[model samples]
Target: MRTGRTAHLLFLADATSVHTQRWVGAMAARGWRCTVVSRLPHEVPGAEVIALGTGEGNAQWLAAAPRVRSLAHRLRPDVVHGHYITSYGFWAAACGVQPLVLTGWGSDILVSPRESRLVRLLTGWTLRRARLITADSRDMLTEIATYAPRARLEQVYWGADTDKFHPVAKAPWPFRIVSLRAWEPNYHIDVIVEAVALLRQAEPGAAIELHLLGGGSMEAPLRSLVRARGLEPFVHFHGKVDEDRMAALVNQASVSVSVPASDATSVSLLESMASGLPVVVSDLPANRQWVDAAGGFVVPAGQPAPLADALKALLREPRLAEQMGRRNRATVERQASRRSQMDRMDVLYRQVLGWTP
Candidate 1:
């Protein structure tokens, strides 16, 4: 089923990001041969997966560059696309591949720049070697330019499956407010818990419920916080649901909340918009770029009181929440459609590979 002329795309990333799975699946649907090489296994069907090892960080990558070069030569890839500019991109670039597309995923540009001198230098080297660098948001692109001004940078938002996530009839019983993100410190799930507790106190008789989906290291701590706060009846944690179930849960929610400490572009927020749910998000630049006053409420970060007020306001006014949800859904239809994102990526990939679309 493989054609000799089919572009062999090597996706370099960590195993955790489902965005890689989505992109690889989309590319495969378009008949491109995709192979994912990373530290962990991906659950995507029809895409070839090769786990290069867990501890294969920059140091290991530096030493294994020659081996990776040999593998690349044998595979003879048409384009090597790295999914995280700092780590994976560094290795991909050092392995001597042409038409290298480096994709900077949030923290690589935002947090990594503030890292040690060695990391910054390595990131710079990776960016310099890239044929083109793609970021998920304009904020991320701007951050990346501080280090690699000469590199070709493109802002490509992670595409959400509108068809899968579109508006559904709200589920009856227990009005759900969901947070679908990794239970990491950066994501600030505990903040959501605190806010939800405050919201419950404000509306004592309200049937409001908080649904948390996804797993991470912070799960234990978050759970302890929930128990300590006596939010057992109101808060439910459904750890890492499949896409279908996740979409269903999104559809069931009256409002979706994400109070990230920092972000480039959030796939969860985009998906929430696509699912036609009103959002209450942190007022970070990245979130503000996606959600405005017209679409969702953007509150200050870390403070649970303001966030609780926003949630309570939305809950008190059902019509307002519905209107915001409709606007959010419309925004996704206009801007963040998967087809549009894929179209842009296709052009960028072709340009990098010197192929005519």
Candidate 2:
């Protein structure tokens, strides 16, 4: 399925994820024939998604292997890449394709493995079959070393589109604080809400508005909590927005927050910084790697008091916010450019396909 310029990529990933779509679109735009095989139906602007129509859990994934292998036989893709090593990676490994690339996205490596010894063993088994392994965070890559060879692994960020996410003219009035993460417990959406409440309590009539973006299982609970705190007027739920809209929201904000309990490098954090907004993130190693002292604050993982304090510091000093914003913009451009990272991936793909530059 080679297009004579780039290799056809058969991706085993969650079709619903923006990360998976972006990967598919980027490669397709580069003249590669891309097809995604997934459990759910979804679309990419320039690629194909083949829904597996199976149930969730280990059994379904195991059950879907024959069909996935059949697709590979017909497609004859130059590379078979899988995202989220625990699920899709398992099927990719089962299919026994050559030049396989498995990407361990955050929790599949960091959190999921700790669930049990069998999960870790399964993770390692899936990883060993890959020709190349990639992850966004250094900590995730470091952890991947325990399962697979360090030589085959690379740190590849799910980068932010710097061009599309540049800063826009924003007002201090309404003082919007956007959280780019979903409402899942992994992201601790309630913590951000609690911090917003604290901010209003400490300084009433501050005109602060909390924008909660992305939808998840915790929506009902979070909404109830917001109502319980009497933050209905102040808190807005923007459930599951597209990339363009998400960027606009980020650009219009005074600040951004992402307090995920665990994450690889966050695309939202990068996008926020790219849009020249100083971010407040959990004190995870991956978060620290990006949000340096100048970029934003690193508060305790689950504590709202420290997060509120960080927000207060930024809101109180416009000059300081602008300074941090400048620093953040510079940092993202240097290290987290979407184009540059994708180009790096192109090189890796070329190498795997044994194509000379």
Candidate 3:
């Protein structure tokens, strides 16, 4: 594969999403003339943006098809890529875009299709329309297979920026546990709060703190749980922070925890690994694809006791935590660094375009 090849890519996605922004930026940097056609327009340098401005609903998507078709005809991009198969993928299919590429973002494939018969059938139809489909994890790829076996599937991770997330000079601080997972229903962040309380009970007078890094529908209830457990002093709710602050927080933290009920390859977990923090992740197949005993402990999800025990062990054994962090850094450098993954993605793009390898 070579760099600096001229290519045009039209992307359909929720431009407001950070993931979308990151993907667009990376793709643009690789010398692609990227144009983002999104419902909600977001600013990303080096790429053209087109806002659909259509209000949400099935009716809106149907209405927007002609507009999308007109735009596609005008641009005539080499490839049409859509993120989140549920919405963008369907839109791309509806617009009759050729050389279509669809990327499934976790719940869109795992949860949304099960909501209704129409959605399941429509999702399968959309999958059949795509020339290539991508998933962030092998588990997700398998799920996508159940819907579209004939659709070409590739497991491509949205990996972490290792240079920005690399280990920093460690300063003496309280044993800090950081979770970048959203405080949402499936994420079970409240379970982490409960785990903290259990840790307090198990270790009589351990100096520890928990940093909840994202906000969601479960924020109020999780805060209430923290208060009820009298964990105000030890738990901190940091709604959300920018990328720099996120890197700093992860670098400072002694351990990271991510126990989502279902997930793909989480950028949070990869960032923690690149930042040289020991992780305690859920034993979900998606998470297991990246995290193992070598990087961190894989505890059973939704179980506070086992979760706390994992956190406690990391807290108790500083050497073990440091050892695991070192291993994690090495693993990420080899497998999940942003540059390497993006290079592989570029190869995929070229392959799809039938460019000579």
Each model's RMSD to truth, in Å? Answer: 2.0, 1.6, 2.1
Counting only residues 3 or more apart in sequence or on different chains, how many pairs clash (N, Cα, C under 3 Å) in candidate 2? 0
- Please report how far candidate 3 places residue 37 from its true position, in Å: 1.3
Candidate 1 per-residue lDDT over residues 236-340, each given as its tens digit:
889988899998889879999998888888888999999988899998888988888777799988888999999898888888888899999999889888878
lDDT of each: 0.83, 0.88, 0.87
Error of 3 at 178 (Å): 0.4
**Each candidate: how many clashes?**
1, 0, 0
Show where candidate 1 strays beyond 4 Å: 1-4, 54-57, 171-173
Error of 3 at 114 (Å): 1.9
Ranking by lDDT: 2, 3, 1
Candidate 2: the clashing residue pairs are none
Q: Tell how far residue 61 is off in model 3, in angstroms.
A: 3.5
Question: Which candidate wins on TM-score?
Answer: 2
lDDT tens digits, residue span 48-105, model 2: 8899889998778777889889888888888899899889988888777888999988
